[model samples]
Target: MVLQRLLLALINRAQLVERLAESKAIRRAAQLTAFAVIKGRLAGKQASARLRDSDTARMMREEARRMPQSAADAAQTVSRIRNTFMKEVKEGMREANRQIKDRK
Candidate 1:
């Protein structure tokens, strides 16, 4: 009877260990999934930023071609354009962040 009790105890311990390992695997999977999601979001954000930057650069170049002859006037125009572009980019990033958070 004692030997039988020992065997039963060992079986229970083995089952507990298995359960623990399974839980760990589940947790790891969840973590990996979260990482993947965040990574994807970051990649998307980077892509959008790149596209926006390219568009802004093109617009700036076009504006520069039409800029006034005076250095001060040209500088002011470029600064204004840059400020507007940056403001739009910031708003876009905020919106993206909100969407990402909502997804989570």
Candidate 2:
């Protein structure tokens, strides 16, 4: 739920940025946001792996069961997450652009 809210906020911000900024800047911001999410997930995985005996580790292990099982699957999952965010950003920008055009 929190992730969804964050993504929605990013989409709104991206829309606003698209109206007032260059394509490169908008792309950079989206990429940075995606990178942060991926980095945080990876950090959690690493920490959970290190703490194998704790209750938190047990929960993490259960959560890990829902994740991809192989390297290719993991890559695809991450790519999908990135693409989803990019799609939302593009959609927001398109909607904002359309609104601006309609007002003219």
Candidate 3:
């Protein structure tokens, strides 16, 4: 699956970043990968809510709290949160990777 490959890439690149700290492209790709993962998580939650069960409404309501203001803001909210998380994680990992390479 795509998720599996993304995880593999992240793990694989962690080592590459460890040794050489690959070009900015690799970092960008990793950030995008993180975004994709977060987007997938949100989508999965939405999908599960769609499969109505006893707690479907409650789950949807809970998810809505994390979402943005208007109905028109839904997609934008998801995109923003995912991107924010990706950026934050990428920055943290980059720092960690730099430390790792420095230690080498």
Candidate 4:
């Protein structure tokens, strides 16, 4: 009985904290200093899509399995990974921008 009561109290405290954290003033104060808006839909299903479909992830796994033959190969690998990742980020940002425009 005592343990159950303690658990209930903890749950209530968590709920209260969540509510407080979502308050407009608190949220405004907690705004990300970087490009949070451009980081759209990156949790859950979206993250799964990134892992399964992103060229960057595929190339990373492929690169990890093999050693680079030379300095140029390593440099090329890095450049390809950078380009693939930037392309995805750009697409995500564009999607986010489109969503914002749709909302308005």
The best candidate by lDDT is: 4
Estimate TM-scores for all models. Answer: 0.42, 0.35, 0.33, 0.56
Query: For candidate 3, lDDT tens digit of each residue in 1-104?
Result: 99999878877876665754467777788899999999999989976764443243444455677756787778765565567556656775897899899999
Ranking of models by TM-score: 4, 1, 2, 3
User: 1 or 4, which is superior by lDDT?
Assistant: 4
Which pairs in model 4 have colliding backbones? none
| Residue-by-residue lDDT tens digits, candidate 2, 5-103 | 987887788666577566777779889999999999998997667456444445446546777789997787667656655665677589789989999
lDDT of 2 at 22: 63
Tens digit of per-residue lDDT, candidate 4, span 15-90: 7879878899778766863346546544666789767988888989999999999999999999999999999899
In order, candidate lDDTs are 0.83, 0.72, 0.70, 0.85
Q: Model 3 segments beyond 4 Å from truth?
A: 1-69
Question: How displaced is residue 40 in candidate 4, in Å?
Answer: 13
Give me candidate 1's TM-score against the actual structure. Answer: 0.42
> How well does model 3 score by local distance difference test?
0.70
Candidate 3 versus the native: TM-score? 0.33
Instruction: List where candidate 1 sits over 4 angstroms from the true fold.
Output: 1-55
Best by the TM-score measure = 4
User: Candidate 1 clashing pairs?
Assistant: none
How well does candidate 2 score on lDDT at residue 52? 61
